[model samples]
Target: MKFKALWITETAEGKFERSIIERSIDDLPAGEVLIRVKYSSLNYKDALSATGNKGITKKFPHTPGIDAAGVVELSRSEHFGTGDEVIVTGYDLGMNTSGGYGQFIRVPASWVVKKPEAFTLKECMTIGTAGFTAATALHKMELLGQNPEQGPIVVTGSTGGVGSLAVAILSTAGYEVIAVSGKQNAWEYLQHLGASRMENREWVNDQSGKALLKPQWSGAIDTVGGNTLVTLLKGCKLEGAVACTGLVGSPKLEGTVYPFILNGVSLIGVGSAEMPMSTKLKIWDKLSGQWNCREKMNAIAKEVSLEELKNTYIDTILKGNVMGRIVVNVEA
Candidate 1:
């Protein structure tokens, strides 16, 4: 079948260029199942991969989408059959391998999860990798004894994809959520996601050189790494937990172990990509069931087409200009 896909090509001069081109089933790598991608989502990693970032994607002439949801077009594994709904995210997808920007994807059976009955394909993509990462962090923190009554849970980068979903899901679970963002213009939007309060970006960039500052938050979900992550660690209450995921700020962590030794603060690292399937399933079940924020997520999501992605969001998202989740209708 003829289908459309975004291809990022590294020119002979080592510059990168993008194109939406036609692909066939033969072009997809061999796997046990074939999915007709109904929806995919734009993510920071996708943006990085599109720009010829060797760390995120060592190869070019590649399709970049870390998240995809659709129906099974074919299956060799007993785990899935044609027309079965499925979700594909993470696990080397859109990295060295062909990804979901194309209308169809063939992947290993273990890499594909049966989409929960309650979650539609579009809704799955709406939440995408960002939502999955947020859910994973919270799941780990809950296991570490995090609770709403401890104190307000602060979410840094609260207007970005993972940050926004973290705010909504944490709020839905009854935590008093304090959203921190540099986009002062989007305070109303953060509140709409159920953040009880707002804090400017400056709130998480403390540099007083104190080994441990006064504990303010009981817990935090940190998407912006670097000094902000360091600040959150310093301010967390005794037994407080902070889930660290993105490195939009910086990957290098330069802080004392004082928070852990003195305050009993737990820093949890979250990695959704290449996340074990067992853990991934648990997070997905919650995202599709009780913590299901499809209605709330739909409100924050802006749909875009494959054709619109390269021209519009590829550059903007890299510059941190996105508002909330950007869901891509690959079928469009």
Candidate 2:
């Protein structure tokens, strides 16, 4: 049967266009499972792909959604059966392969996870890759022995999808969250997400030549790397850990190791794309259960139809004007 999908096609002159196209199951890449996608969420990477960013995607005429939640329509693996609720994120969902922007997706069984009982398929996509990444960063910090008693935990880029969710999750987990963002309008929103305090981007960007600063924060989840990360390193409490995820600011890390050797600060790298399946499952369960912030999650997400995704990508994420997650209802 043919299904509707938002397909990206490239002209011979290299221009890209997005339109609703009809596709069949046979059009999908070979995989052990086929999913009828219920919902998908937009991410920075998806915007990159939609705009022909070679770093995130090498091919045109491709769907560009990195995260999806839906039900199994077909399965070749014994691990999952037809009609089972499931989620698939990362692992080439939107890069070179067809992604969740479509009404259907075929992926390797290993790339699929059973939707946690605490969440519906729509709710799972509401959390999506961004929320999952935030949770993963917090989980790593907790594993490194980070606690609320040490000092306030800072969240940079605090109004974006991952940053906002990180603030909510950390606050819910009993940590005092200090949100840092340049979007002045987001202060109230961040406060609603449970941030104890807010810092303008300028405040966090202030640089001192000193290798280490006052060691103010006990721990942090940094989504904007580069100079912001450097500043964060200088201010981290002794023996504190900071999980670095995105490069929205800059990818280069330029600073002294005094924070590491002298203050014993730890820099943890969080990558959700290639994480082990077992680890993904654990994090998903936590997000669905204890760490789940339905109110905050709902507050940070906007629902849109697949047809609206193109304009949303160009006008919002690509321009960095987005405030929270954009959840796409493929069938809407």
Candidate 3:
């Protein structure tokens, strides 16, 4: 079958070009399930791949979308059958593998999750990888005994995809949220997402030479790494956990081990890209049930056509100007 897809090609002169192109089912890489993707979502990693980031996509021509929600069109695995609604996120998708920017995606059965009845395909794309990451961070934190009663949870980079979802999900799970953002106009948006309060980026960008600072929040979900991560660890309450999910600020983590030793604070790395299927199912269950924040997520999400994604939203997200999730209508 012929289908439309976003195509990225690198020029010999060393620049990347993007276009909408036609593809065939025969062109897809080998996999156990073939899905007719109805919706996908834009993410930082997708932006990187589309712009010729070798670390993301080593090949010249590729499709870049880390999240896809659709119906099975073909299946080689007994675990999934044709017509099953499903989701594909992380793993090697949108990186070394062809991803959801296409109208169809063929992926390993193990990388596919049957869509929860509670979420529609579009709704599944709305949550996408960003929501999954945020929810997983909270899941891990809870597993480590972090709780709402311990104190409010702080979320950094609060206007971005992951941060926005983190704020909404944590609040839905009964925690008071302190959102931190560099954007001056984000307070109202953050408040709408259920943040009890908002703080400037400086609040969590401490530069003090001290090993630890006064305990601020009970725990944190940090999307900005480097000094911001250090600040989160330094200011967390005793036995509190800090879930690290991004490196938007910087990848380097330069801080003393004092927080871990003295306060028993824990730093949890949330690597959703390669997250286990079992854990993915557990997190997705909570997102669609007890942690259902569809109203807030819907409010934060805006749909875009594949054309619009390549022409506009990708660059917008790279510039750090996007306020929330941008769900891609692959069928559009």
Candidate 4:
């Protein structure tokens, strides 16, 4: 069957081109389930893939969207059947696989989760992979005994997708949240998402060359890696856990072990894409129930069509200009 999709290709000059075009359902990779996608979400990784970032996607002529929510049209696994509403995020969906940029996606049944009772397909995409990563960080931190009562939690990159959701989720879970952002103009938006206050990036990006600094927060959800990750560890309180979620700043970690040995600080790595299905379900359940931040979701979401993704957002995101999650209406 013919379907609409955003397609990316690399030219002989090594430049990548993006366009919306028609695709065939038969062109999809072999999988146990076929979903008619109603919605997908834009992520930084998707922007990288769309721009021919070889690290994110190895092939050209690809569809780039890592998070998808829709209804199952076919299924081979006993876990799902036709007409089942489902969500698929992470696990190679947008990398080497034809992904959610298309109106349809066929993926392994194992990669699919039945849509939570509280979320419509659009709402699911609103939370998307960004929120999933944030939730995973919270899950791991709490597993290590970190709690809101420990003290205020800091969310770095507070205006971006994961950071924005992290602030909301942490606050919804009863933590006092301090949002860190370089954008001085986002204070009101941050406050609306439950952040108690805001800090400039310099507040967390210490450059004093000290091995450690005074503890500013009880714990943290850091999306900006490299020196920012180091700063978080150096300044974290005893038993404080830092969930390292992204490397947008840089992939390098140049720091000492003093935080782990002398301060009892723990660094939790959140790799949501490859997390076990049981854990994925657990996080999704929390997001839909106890951790549901419906108001925050509404405030943080901006819907766009496939053409807009190609004409605008894909480039805008790479430039770090987007404020919140951009949910895509694939059928629009």
**lDDT of candidates 1 onward, in order:** 0.90, 0.87, 0.93, 0.93
Backbone clashes under 3 angstroms, per model: 0, 0, 0, 0
Higher-lDDT candidate of 1 and 2: 1
TM-score of each: 0.98, 0.97, 0.99, 0.99
- Between candidates 2 and 3, which one is better according to lDDT? 3
Lowest lDDT sum, 10 consecutive residues, model 3, at 273-282
Model 2 TM-score?
Answer: 0.97
Worst 10 residues of 4 by lDDT: 315-324
Candidate 3 local distance difference test against the native: 0.93
Which ten residues in a row are the worst by lDDT in model 1? 287-296
Query: Which wins on lDDT, candidate 1 or candidate 3?
Result: 3
The count of residue-pair clashes in candidate 4 stands at 0
Error of 4 at 16 (Å): 0.4
Give the TM-score (vs. native) of candidate 3. Answer: 0.99
Residue runs of model 3 more than 4 Å from their true location after superposition = none
Q: Which 10 successive residues of model 2 have the least lDDT summed?
A: 311-320
Candidate 1 yields a Cα-based lDDT of 0.90
Measured with C-alpha atoms, the lDDT of residue 317 in candidate 1 is 87
